[model samples]
Each structure stands twice: as C-alpha cells, then as structure tokens.
Target: MVFLIQKSQNKDSKAIHLKLSEIIASHQGTSNRMVNIEDLTELELDQLRKFYVQLSKLAAKEDA
Candidate 1:
C-alpha cells in the first residue's frame, strides 16, 4: 500500500521531507509523495524508518 506522510513544518523538516520525497520518487518511479510500502525491501524500510525517527527527533530538538 502507498503511504502519504503529512508535510513537515520548518526549514530543516522541509529539507528532510524533500530528501525523503526524492528517495521515494527514485525508488518508486513517480512524482507523487506516496511511497509504496510493499515495494521496499526489509532493509530499505528499516533505513527509511531510522531516517524518519531521526528527522522527528531533530524537529523536536528545534522546538525545544
């Protein structure tokens, strides 16, 4: 299934979001932000998840 995450809120987040978008687009061959969960291998998904977690933590730090 395709997952469409919400847009991020600041410059750092926007950058991270753009990077992730690019990664998804590159992997999925589409311009849309939607990522196909089933298309990704386990390792790729784990790395993506880790990047997402890091981005969240970084955003939280910016808020503090």
Candidate 2:
C-alpha cells in the first residue's frame, strides 16, 4: 500500500502517506496508537480535502 501511494503524482497524497508511514513506524505496541484517521472530525476531514485539492492544482500546474 505504501509503495503504491508513494508512487502517486499528487504531492498531497504522497505527503499524507509519508506522514501515515511515520506514525505507523513509531508505534510501540499493538494496543496503543496515536494516529487515528477514523476519529477525525468532519471539519478536519474538510480541511484535509481542501489541502488535497490545493496540492492537486499545484501538481497539475507542475505537470503542465
């Protein structure tokens, strides 16, 4: 999954995946974890989507 995501042309997706990788890598136990995408609030999800859209535009410009 990480390999596929890291290959993404969209910088936001790549960056988000990297951050997720770091969070998983730093985990110490099976029961305890800090990164929880499922627990994100609606506002946070909206913000994340906005960021992705912004980055996607930048990616398109770069491609052009």
Candidate 2 local lDDT, 1-64, one digit each (tens): 8876654435445445544544444447332332454355545655655765676687689999
* Residue pairs with backbone atoms closer than 3 Å in model 1 (clashes): none
lDDT of 1 at 57: 80
TM-score of 2: 0.46
Relative to the unseen true structure, what is the Cα RMSD of model 1?
Answer: 11.6
TM-score for each predicted model, relative to the true structure: 0.47, 0.46
In order, the Cα lDDT scores of the candidates are: 0.53, 0.53
Q: How well is each residue in 1-64 modelled by candidate 1, as lDDT tens digits?
A: 1232332133335455545655643644655443444444546555766776787788689999
Q: What is the lDDT of residue 16 in candidate 2?
A: 57
